[model samples]
Target: MNGGILHALLEFAFYYPLVMSLIWMSGGIIYFLRWERREPSRVRPRPLPDYPMVTLVVPCHNEGAQVRETIAHLASQQYPNFEIIAINDGSTDDTGAQLDQLMDQYPALRVIHMSSNQGKAMGLRAAALASRADFLVCGDGDALLDDYATHWMMMHMLESPRVAAVTGNPRIRNRSTLLGKLQVGEFSSIIGLIKRAQRVYGRIFTVSGVIACFRKSALHDVGYWNTDMVTEDIDVSWRLQMRHWEIRYEPNALCWILMPETVRGLWKQRLRWAQGGSEVLLRYTTRLFKWRQRRMWPVAFEYVMSLLWSYTMSVIILLWVLGCFMPLPPSLYVDTLLPQWHGVVLGAICLLQFLISLLVDRRYETRIGRNYYWMIWYPLVYWLLNTATSVVALPKAIMKRRGTRAIWVSPDRGLR
Candidate 1:
């Protein structure tokens, strides 16, 4: 192959990835514009006949160290007519004992101990069955909710009776290490952008499991969480939407979750999330075009495209790297050719968008310093890390050999 042809092929290869990124960025911008224009005041609160009974359910497995603090936080909620139920899903540690101690201190608290580990879905199922409340507030045992978290979530639900579920913001509680800081930035950009998009579309794609409120009737309508899939949260969200039920994103309702402090820990946690997401896509792929509602189609398309893009971009990155090292045939090179000017322009756009995301992060409560230099470097490093994870997850999820059934790995615990 001639040098010119090889260069052309390399350039074309670059354009494919650039195009994907551009599409994502464009969608993100549209989402932001729509979200900014939304009038929060216009969405007036509905006067509830009474403070509906709420059951705050915490599903735990080998999270003994964090259970007490989590329970204490739930017990501290200012909301009236609420119960705190902590389901210990067969914790090998002293989680049962910790819950027992809390039960004695707070009579409103209830504990359910399982003989064996049955993952979060089963734990939540058990907790929901035990509670005799009008609403269910499901959260992780390692999560800490803000004082007004439940109140705001309930208000949102009341305001939008069509909404089957309400999801709150999940902020990183541990940003002491470099890894943690990068995660904070990544989460702020990705989740923040997605939530804004969801608000605009009036269809939330997935409710963060860290803290979400669900109408008991909605769960019953959709048949609750699917224990078969690894990502029950996402599965349940899709099911709710399929039933013509609405889901709301409440930024004011806040919950803090611990991020993985170490690189290894972070990788494992991401693997489970990525794999679970893919599984949800696979399980619901058929429902994509079948759903009669227009809202459901867009949400389904977004999720399917996201998964495909992740794996496709990973392949493009690898091809680009190989093209740089090995001599390729002229035909292959030309087919993948991208212009240098396009690369420069695309790179600048990505950098600019990333900066905007960083600014959004600053608006939120972050422990990291608000330095311009640090923010610039943070996004680049975080993007690289995310790309690497997506690359690894592509194959791991394909093999269906990764992820754990045991709930011992608690990334949220370290955040507190």
Candidate 2:
């Protein structure tokens, strides 16, 4: 690469994140002021004129240790007129038996035993077909849903017929290790801010797969979740939006869940996420040029830019590593590897972004600031992890054949 080109790419690597941080910070603040401040019941569920029948769909695969607690939480929902449906997606463990025992305990609890392992998408499709309710709250088997979460999500669904889904806030439950602790900050500072900002930008890229409420009609209209997609949540989000349905983000709806504390586990999870995103972009980019799809233009464009940024960073890192072993052009050596004023500015911006997210999210999670010290490692650790995963996962996504069934097994749930 020429010296000028190297300088430009180095500038992009440093400034891209700074620019995005400002966007997220400003957009998140605007969203909170306009939409979140005036809510009447932020902590509890308010009585509605009528409580529509809803089904809580839980997809379980080898969740023997966690299913009991999850079901116990679901049975205690504050919302009225709701039932629990747990689908055992061919678990090799005791997940099926536990759900069967729970079925005997809670009259509202029902269990579906898949003879063989089908993917989460198939499990959800089966449950939706069996469900008698028009609205559905879907969550992971290991997740603990707040008693009032369904009520908050339902408020959005009931308010507008166009609202197809409402994604809840996911809080990390395990923070014993440094990795887990940093992830707590990550979810708040990075994921939470992006969702709020994207909502303000007029379309969400995807709903939280761990916790979200859906309208059955909207799912039907979009042909339900794509069974072959690596991440059904992302695929469904795009399809629903392309069909002109709306998806909202509900910060008040909280779901406490476990994350991968180990580096290998976290890498696997993020790689799947990145590949799913690439698959969605490749599948839908051609369709986004129409006038009706103008609203989604920003989302697609942002994702493309992010992919380019990831590759750019990866190349810089690779060149830097190579230079350490041998000689390189002076321009590449100085601009890419050495710290400068831009580095200081980037660090300051990261801190500001974390502070902004913590302030906006503290309403949902009290004591969120307790994790502030841990966020010091986020910029260095997560940026590299995400960049590497994006670079590696793109090729995998492209190579994946059509009509491949995306299956699942239980992931690392951190230390007990």
Poorly placed runs, candidate 1 (over 4 Å): 1-49, 291-293, 321-325, 331-373, 378-385, 391-416
| RMSD (Å) of each candidate, 1 decimal | 4.6, 1.3
- In terms of lDDT, the best-performing candidate is 2
Q: Give the per-residue lDDT of model 2 (tens digit) for 83-106.
A: 999999999999998899888899
**Candidate 1 per-residue C-alpha lDDT over 236-275 given as tens digits, one digit per residue, 9 for 90 to 100:** 9988988889887766577888878776777777777776
Q: Count of backbone clashes for each model?
A: 9, 0
State the local distance difference test value for candidate 1.
0.71
Instruction: Pull out the clashing pairs in model 1.
Output: 9-333, 11-337, 11-338, 12-336, 12-337, 12-338, 13-336, 258-412, 258-415
Model 2 poorest ten-residue lDDT run? 331-340
What are the TM-scores, per candidate, against the unseen true structure?
0.83, 0.98
